[model samples]
Target: MTPEARKNAVRWSVFALVGAVITVSLLFGGVSDFHPTAVVRKVYDEVEALPDGSPILISSDFDPGSEAELKPMMDAVLEQCWRKNLRVIVMTICSPNSPELADSIVRASADAHGKVYGTDYAVFGYLAGGSAPILALGQDWHAVYKTDRGGTPCRDLPAMKGISKLTDFPLCLEISAVSTIDYWILAGNAKYGLKLGLGVTAVMATDYYQYLATRQVVGIIGGVSGASQYESMTRQDALRKARETKEAGDLASARMPTQSAIHVTIILLVVLGNILYFAGKRKEKASP
Candidate 1:
């Protein structure tokens, strides 16, 4: 056979093998449950179990570039808060881009949970000056967020009616791609006594963990996996609350199969690529 034919055969064999592996993985690993899906779920569950009408402040401090790691976690936490009928105040620091992205995610999740704006949730929009605005919020949330995102008076919004300060909120959740979590720890939790739950990318998780371990922050969700874990956990918590608690068992179970399969597939790909490389080297040595 020609060299071209041999190359084609190798390529086809690899493709078929990959397809089979993926199929097997999906069939075996596709189950879902109530355990923590990611680090964010822990954060979400911390707030979800809070009393209804309890104020929760969320500082969504990421831009579109980091949305993949941030958006799902935001969705999970906001969904839980809305379901629990918690009063929410969504804001942003770092980038002007964050507020709009956060607003869209929160609103969509709230709508899914049948929450009403101006009543169940409110957006204070983006605050400027990065850490400076976050610090100011701790000092006086009302001064920082006297109005809703759309310029509506906070006094008129039932959700914001009695929320004059960040301390009034029992929980403060910060979803950050930047290091904005530090500002919350320094200002909000340390100073104003707000409970801090942080959602950050996997790379930033360690930086936040020191605070988490010290009890400076209540909980954290790290990266996409963390977000998925949190979503699964919250889903389980909700399912358990209802009569359909059986689904709760599937959360971690379902995810583990996929995660394991992914690891295996990566290993297999590396092995196959190395084999191809060495085989090519042998052919080169044997050539005329």
Candidate 2:
């Protein structure tokens, strides 16, 4: 090959190599036993300790753009709640994307745990008008979510049978990419006195902490790392009495694996590019 052509090839190869290394490193980091913060631990512990069959509202206040951080957190929370046999009520107050994203995650997570829809959990889906919808929930849940996402009447769902208002729920967990905490605080918690919790991105964690300190929120699980922490907390709680280490260890493990795989694949591409670059250089030097 021409010298110029060969040089261009080597440059591209180098770029590829760097990309690969970064990818792999990130992948390893994701699976690595990254420690959880005190806040995360508190969040997990509170949720885990809730009485079985306790109802909790999980609001998927996220869009496609923020799914990366929010999705994993949602998965982890759902898994823990399902394992503990919590009655989850999924809803979305802020974004239009809430219904689809929240429903997808809940259905998948529930399926994994063999949770029957309308019995084990019920999704109220996206309620209209943000705070308006939330406030309506305080007055009467059936008024807002007369039917679930599947078009089944909420009154007919076993999960919604006795639950009429927000306060009836033992806990309310809002998994939001947006800062819609105020609506719930104003409508649900302040009005009816329902216990509220938050799962927000790391960026939002700080602000939520302030809310938590004020007792506005019972707990806050912030970011993907926080989700991983919850996973660990779940495992610990599940096997607390089990003599076998494996059973206990299985708890809190991440239900999300795609992020790690993507990181690893990127790293491999980077490493290969570097190797090809060096190999091509050596070949060029050896030739006339």
Q: In each prediction, how many residue pairs overlap at the backbone (N, C-alpha, C within less than 3 A)?
A: 13, 11
For model 2, how does the per-residue alpha-carbon lDDT over 1-288 read when each residue is reduced to its tens digit?
999998899789767765665555444422334466777776677788899888877888888887877776787788788888888888887777678877887898799889999999988666668688777787888887878988999899988767888778778888887768778878778877878888888788887677777778888887766776775555444334432332222222332343455556668767986898899899999999
The TM-score between candidate 2 and the true structure equals 0.74
Question: Candidates' TM-scores?
Answer: 0.74, 0.74
Q: Tens-digit lDDT track for model 1 on 18-130? A: 67776777565444443564344457667767988788888889999988677767776776776777888888877877778878888877887788888888887777775
lDDT of 1: 0.74
Worst 10 residues of 2 by lDDT: 246-255
